[model samples]
Target chain A: MSALLDSVLATAVPLDRALLLAAVLFSIGLAGVTSRRNVLIMLLSVEIMLNAANLALVTFSKVHGDPTGQVFVFFAMTVAAAEVAVGLAIVIAVYRLRRTTDVGEVAALHEIDYGPVRYPQLEGQPVHHHGSSGNGDGDGDAGETGGQPAVASEEAHG
Target chain B: MTEVLFYCFAAVAIASAVIAISRKNAVASALWLVLMFFALAGTYVLLEAWFVAVIQILVYAGAIMVLFLFVIMLVDLKSEELAVMGAPRFRALGLLTSALFLAVAVFVVLNTRETFVAAADTWDRGGALEVESGSAAGIGHYLFHRWVLAFEVTSVLLLSGMLGAVILTKRRLT
Candidate 1:
């Protein structure tokens, strides 16, 4: 047995290869999380990202011939489990309240509105295209009507 | 022999990961993730960490991923259109970042002169890592001896997580 390949065979592969693979996985996870919306899928993407890091850690541990990385992996898994538990609970609550788990709709809540932002009750209330009339007088006219005109227009759509 | 297995499994792992991320259906994505985990376990085997490979299969592929599947089954997510494709800027940014990272990783790997193989030769006979018939013995010794405290802490954390999860889902009395 050739010493280099034989030794590598024993460990399974070169450290460089393992590291590169882990990095690729990590980037895939990163892209998934960045682009995907559905909160559940986002959380899953995060899990994948964490796994990618764990792969790197374990690969390094094997390369160094140490058990420390395994120990760290155990801790990381524990933390990941905890994160999922909390995260899923939040997603469930959000889904229950929102009806539709669409992130685009949720962004509307960030607007400075003067009423209770009851999202659960607002899911199918009709599309509120307040400023989409291509008019620069939105803020000026909105002050006179206290945004009632927007609600009226939406009710007309409904 | 090992190098071939390593490359094969690595390719499988990467391809499956990409499939997992790109699949529009959540369940299909989870299935791809399972394949990716299995391929990763194969890579671990090639690395000679037999026990780690088993744990990778049992814990990650078997247990953790099962939980992910369960959660995916439980949730009812609306099928969102793959709209990020509509944004050219985001796609451009993603490609740029991935390419940059790949370039840096390759540069680092090529620049490193001495590798783990040289160290392994000297460290094999007498070192912190005790080679055994199988990794089970070595891992068992280290886990119980060197990592006893951390193990116990993990147990506590898991317990707390279970309780916390139950509490989060429980109906509150008015």
Candidate 2:
């Protein structure tokens, strides 16, 4: 009976344990975001990450002599809610257009046909990696400033 | 005693969170996330932040979760159409990268380890109520007095976010 009760209860958790829990939750969320192609999953993963942050903040506030960390958690929650609202709106817009939510297929903004990507030894074709930040159906004008496959800024050591 | 509750909550929250995010169905994922939020709220209570614990339940588990479910319903996505999870080769790379990140994060947490040895004579220990800095009322004072400007800004942000969502998706519901 004593052993059973002992199993049920535990000693006081150290500060590190809280931090450790936060880290675990954060990492799990991070991995979920990376692995999940669904935009909704990514957004949910973001929520998990935000919750981890809140956990850490509250823990720190208790350890120290302050309520600032808890206050910060409220701010975080507000931001998170706002972000989800906006993100879900965007996701809906995208889904309506393409009828799919796959991030890979939603590559309308990808750098199309620069050159043989990844293998830079066949021929050191000048890589025109001029990065474009524009997002619209009409991104061709921006690509006009695009360089060749490989921009030889420096002399290629033949 | 507190340690036991903390560990149990933490373990269950993490496990459920994993289940939540890994589920293929978005609705299932949201449900799992609700479990996580509840467990997290329990941890907050254990930490003696009763107000935060209440808000955690009310805001995160209650309001936020309902919003997520609503959005999920609106999206009404099919599993087949939801296929943007990258390729097998790239998926492996992402997994490896996230694993590395997880390892580094754990290492940092361990390195910065600090135990939460609660000192005597605070309101938490059935002590005097003279020093109530970490209480909910204290947090409210800090927010309205010290961080009032930021607080107002957050309200504005929330309003704008609501307006933006309405503007973005206000079409014929087919």
Candidate 3:
């Protein structure tokens, strides 16, 4: 018990421990993002990734006797806040219209449809929504920037 | 002594993380994630990065997760879908990439032999234990002196985030 208590006290020994732990957390978050269907849960997994990165930055900063990494972690925290704000807003909008946040349910924005939608199309390739009536109004095209798949493509059609 | 404690927290942190990913219930998964953060923070403290550890708990486990919970509660995502997850190809890719990363990490750890070198050079602890880095004063001095511009920039970023969040959350002008 005392040994456990000793570990509980934070110190450099724990910092190295934290680095290893963060690596594991980072991998688990990666797995969660890959496997999960719920879009919101997937976003949470992204948060886990950011935190894991923070763990690494802070650990190394201390190890090297430098504070620059912590400053970077500060920036990461800020970016994370912005991402959550935008992402959750988008998720709420999609949920309001489609009544679900499941990736499979939002099929109206599939890869096959990518011509008429006003929103940016998914990067790299235009996905044409399968079976979408070719309205030719750009409604068939969906694009996502920054690797976050765009939301409410179904609502755009409905 | 310290090595043993390090391994213990390391194990607990890794286990909680695996549980967080594998748990079926989303809420349960989030809870496990919170535990993982706490354990991670504990690890930070052990490293003598007290400020980072405190900030980790305060910002991540505290503020950020609160936002996540709020969003989870607010969003109704229980409806069934045509597909629950992506193609198995993605999963295979993830596993392959992560396995490669783990192999690299193991190689790096095993090859590096430099654990302790310069205590007498910059520190007088002489292999004795010390909690806070003697450089804390220097950190504060730099933050207030040379890094003031960056500090102000962070304030601007926070302000923008608040406004952006409000604009994003507000109903669109139909």
Candidate 4:
């Protein structure tokens, strides 16, 4: 047991370990952004990426005993806050129009006609048909669906 | 003791990050992300970056996460709709690509061991006097003095971002 502990301690240099953790976290965030269809979750993944970058910055700051990296992290945090504000506003706007947060549902510019994008998960329910006219005005056409009333009322509330 | 603590924090951070990304529900994902941020804050403390650690908790775990949760609630996705991740093939491809990227990053870090060691030696030679660099006082000295211009720029950026968000979300201009 002592031998195992010694090995672990000896191998775990704080700087290297922290960098590795940042890298892993970054890759996980990348996976999240790529796999998740929900725009909100994608934004969350982006935050993860920014946080990983901040971790790396702080780790390097410690290594050099310089506060510049920490200052940069402060700026990064500010930028991230701003980004989330704008991004969530955009998400809310999109959600208001589409009534669904799925990226698949908002592919008004995908350049391919898949015959009214289908949500296999929401089986037997009315699929939020979009882009069938191919005019790239999916938002306007979305009003024809059954979910339109709720979105309209929400827009009015806003 | 520090080594043990570092490992514990790293483990928690990684585990929570994995869970944060994998959860089907955005609210669950946001909550797990908060846990991950806390773990990362612990790691920051271990690194002696006390100020950064505090900001990590305040800005990330507290404010940013609350914004995420608010949006999640506002969007209010049904459980069935939230379950619809992308196609299995795309997910597999993404995971594979990120795994490859991780491999490359780890390789680069390992190969640059000598460089990092040299940097550490330099710090030991002259940087020890500034050991308080991670403290709020230390950081403030640089932020307000040397980086004041950048600081002002950041304020402007924040102002613009606020205005842009307001314009984007407003239902009507009148």
Question: How many collisions per candidate?
Answer: 4, 12, 26, 0
Q: Against the unseen true structure, what C-alpha lDDT does each candidate score?
A: 0.67, 0.74, 0.64, 0.81
DockQ, model 1, C-alpha based: 0.18
Query: Candidate 2, A3: how far from true, in Å?
Result: 24
**Cα deviation of B45 in candidate 3 (Å)?**
0.8
Model 3: CA > 4 A from native: A1-18, A104-158, B79-83, B113-140
Candidate 1, residue A55: lDDT: 79
Q: Which stretches of candidate 1 lie over 4 Å from their true place?
A: A1-12, A107-158, B81-88, B120-129
Scanning candidate 1 chain A in windows of ten residues, the lowest lDDT window is: A117-126
Ordered by TM-score, highest first, the candidates read 4, 2, 1, 3
Question: How many backbone collisions does model 3 have?
Answer: 26
Native contact fraction of candidate 3? 0.34
Interface DockQ per candidate: 0.18, 0.24, 0.19, 0.29
Order of candidates by lDDT, top first? 4, 2, 1, 3
| Docking level for model 2 | acceptable
lDDT of 4: 0.81
The most accurate candidate by lDDT is: 4
- Give the clash count for model 2: 12
Ranking of predictions according to DockQ: 4, 2, 3, 1
What does candidate 2's lDDT look like per residue over A32-147, in tens digits?
A: 88888888888999999999999999887767757888889889989988888888888877666666667766778744554333321222333444333332234334343224
Query: In order of the candidates, what TM-score does chain B achieve?
Result: 0.82, 0.82, 0.79, 0.92
lDDT by residue (tens digit), candidate 4, B1-174: 667888899999889989988888888999999999999998887776779999999999999899889989998899889888889999899889889989998998788767667765665466642657778999899999999999999999999999989977776442
